[model samples]
Target chain A: MPKQVDHRERRETIARALWRVVEQRGIAHASVREVAQEAGISHGAVQHYFATREEMLVFAMDFASEQTSLRVAERVAELGDAPHPRDVLRVTLTEMLPLHPEARATSRMSAAYVLEALHDAHIHARAREGLTHGRDLVEDLVRQAITDGHIDPDRDPAIETNLLLALTGLTPLVELGVIEPREATTTIAHHLDRLFTNRP
Target chain B: MPKQVDHRERRETIARALWRVVEQRGIAHASVREVAQEAGISHGAVQHYFATREEMLVFAMDFASEQTSLRVAERVAELGDAPHPRDVLRVTLTEMLPLHPEARATSRMSAAYVLEALHDAHIHARAREGLTHGRDLVEDLVRQAITDGHIDPDRDPAIETNLLLALTGLTPLVELGVIEPREATTTIAHHLDRLFTNRP
Candidate 1:
């Protein structure tokens, strides 16, 4: 009997492959042929799923975002009931960090998209929208922490969220050798401690 | 009599034009013709100075680094006898922020090169070396602050320096709408205050 394949699952698998290529080789090299090879499919099969390179990139970005959201939700769910706001914030914030392999790949792909976005308005808009949604999630978490007394009530949640997201951008800078990794991690840890310790 | 153009000065002027084109239109769009048009010079004149687009870009990066060093040195010199490390750090770090028009343009050009550096080894190495030098400057400032008792002696200067540079990356992220600008600034202010004040 022939192996059964879910079309949706197959598309997602192909998207993942394309994302990895973008992350490792850069968006400029993420051709349909390359993605197809990475996905262990024929170039024509990849073309069948994604008519154009732009379409593949767009789908890949969406796939990455969905994966990110799912991971955050999973981590949040694992906290169970009456979780400390700090713990909630840590899990949420760390999910966005390039600590895990998947997150690291996502970060690289996102960074590549940022460069591509400079020339492509459609991609730029999508990237900006994704970033806004991510920031909103962080803001919501910060607000929850403030209300729960896990963070300083006087602290501005919006600003705190923004800082956290900004910190997220640091990982790529370090990875790109623009800054030292140790320095980046330590600095982030210090900032988070001060931000979450409920101290003035 | 016709105006005499100094070859060295003209070359520098051409490099600045390259920077501006990259800043406004992204690095990929910064061709010899575009740069020459922007500089109000002949396309042949650009080749006489830069040989190729890559050479022009490399020269521009060096020029930017030199300009930054001079500005920081001047600022430090202005602080002669009575030195407030907090104030100095604030001013220096703020100078790096894309708050002003010129700084914003410089930042865009830098970001464009950063994307190029991802694939180009020579550019990547130069970026790495320059970044290391930047971190060293920040580290030196932090060390001075420690000696003067502006920052807590026990506080890790290296980490603090990294944090400052990380914040630099964050500024553009905010400007690009990848993060909320208000939130980013507030977070940075809070972090800086904590770093200098040693408050929890």
Candidate 2:
């Protein structure tokens, strides 16, 4: 058996290759052989990490989601202690959009997964879980803002959360060139201003 | 030479078969042969209408979108001349969601196209056009509501249009059973209430 570190490294390498294939072609075209060729590894090596194509795709999806979460965490850390509630909410939500080239791939994977989830139960559950987690995060922030007097106490946090997170649904339009990334960001900022009661 | 009526009828038949294939097995598995088999027509007949696979897919997408629009128009016609703005907005947006069995297929196809648009230039353009059209419809509705004093005039019509239509983004989650269709409708109604100043 390989050591733990080697096993983790091999899996990471395979997942990255899978993402590249998914990014270049649609997920439908990301066959095991395609990923193997992209990774410069044998099909057997790729199988050693993920026995089935579904397994590989699921792992890659989770990995892409984790990468986004990590980036958000890093950005929050850079904001230092006591970041404004609106600023934190803005940064976190903006990170979810495909505003940057680096984020475009993950956003694409996510959009692909939404369709896949329609046909597959397991993928559906994972996609649902990811969306729920995102909603919960935004809801928490909205609740904090309300408590901090940044937003109206009369507003329903869940509805606000849903509305705010739904804006990320425009991510595909941004990616498809229907709207500019800057336009999406501007829309988000505009909505945020409306949500906050006391604007600086 | 085929008559104009025959040309239109044949294309519509082929497009319906293509939609069935897409609904059953997803857009990736929708091949010309599969669509032909489903339509009970010869492969040559299918080819006579659509010389290429992309042409067939694009036609089916437009057909499906048109079907949804027709449904919306029919629904609005039934609502009489004095329909409230909120009711009009709710019904229009609800029609876009995959809340019914009939709509689930079109919703799935739309979701699949979001991924396809990422890799195909022609599809990207068509998808962009559809999104822009949807946004415009919603924006126009918001403007009318503001003018009628149904909503606050201070709200940015474009931003409100974006946020309202973005709720349709939750359609996938509803289709996947992550949330009930009723919950989505409820959320839509909740937001509409928040938008209107004098909710009875």
Candidate 3:
């Protein structure tokens, strides 16, 4: 009897390989052959999952999104019901940034996909979807803070949330050794202090 | 005799061509042949200028730095002596961010070079040099603000200046259409208001 291969498992394995390659090689060498070599699978088998380079790239981006979203959801669940908006914002944003190795890999992959977004419409939509989703989640948290009276009633949630998200997403620069991590922490604390106005 | 070439002028023209190509196609396609085609010059002519891809990339990055530095100096000169610290900070930062096409092109080329920095040491140094120079300029401005009594004495100039430079560098996300320009401008204005309390 022929051996059965789990296609889904194979795809995940390939995506993990893709992330590893992108993390180390900066996404320029992430060809199917390269990923296959990294995954210890045959090139033909990898292609059996992704038909084109774009297909492979799109799949890799979606995988990154799923991984990040899962991590965010898990962290949120641990906060229990009606968590503080500030904590929610901190966890979600920090998770998205490249503070540690895992986050850095994800961030590097994100940078790759974002550049791809400029050239490919499918990747562009996926990149936009991920960013919009992140913005909405953070926006809702800001809205909750308003309802809970943790901030001034007069504060514009949209503009404030945009600041939070942009500032938060910048941690990757720290990981790149461009900005000192200590400085990024201090800067973030300063902004967060001004943003909530009523932090406990 | 072959046509006489001014080496300095030829290099500048090639650098401009590289920027135009990088502006159009992300740096991944910024190969010598492609750049030569964009410049309407022979590939051999381009090769006569840059022996390798890294050579070409480094030239491009230096060109970007020179362009940005020139713009910053011109803006600062317009402010004259004893300029308000707030205005000085605002002008230096707004010039760095991608609020217009010229700034956007520089920012896009920057994002391209930054990824390459991960794998190329020469490109890495160029990126770091540009960033460090920007930080030093902003830090001096921040220090001047302190002397001018525009901000609280207790504020740490290092941390605050780090915040200012990092936050300002991120406006390209606005140019990417990820964030609305209006929102970015408002958020930046809010931060500046807090940074320099004694504004004009």
Output the number of the DockQ-best candidate: 2
| Candidate number with the higher DockQ (1 or 3) | 3
Best-to-worst ranking by lDDT: 2, 3, 1
DockQ of each: 0.41, 0.61, 0.46
The candidates, ranked best first by TM-score, are 2, 3, 1
Q: List where candidate 2 sits over 4 angstroms from the true fold.
A: A147-149, A198-200, B1-3, B198-200
Best by TM-score: 2
lDDT of 2 by residue, A48-121 (tens): 98899988888888888899989888888899998888778787888988888668778777777777776788
Per-candidate TM equals: 0.81, 0.92, 0.90
lDDT of 3 by residue, A107-189 (tens): 78888777767767777776787777777877887888888889877888887776776675454356457677666766777
**Candidate 3 CAPRI grade:** acceptable
Residue A174, candidate 1: alpha-carbon lDDT: 66
Is candidate 1 or 2 superior in lDDT?
2
DockQ for candidate 2, C-alpha atoms? 0.61
- As for DockQ, the candidate ahead, 2 or 3, is 2
lDDT, each prediction: 0.73, 0.81, 0.76
Query: Clashes in model 3: which pairs?
Result: none
Top candidate (lDDT): 2
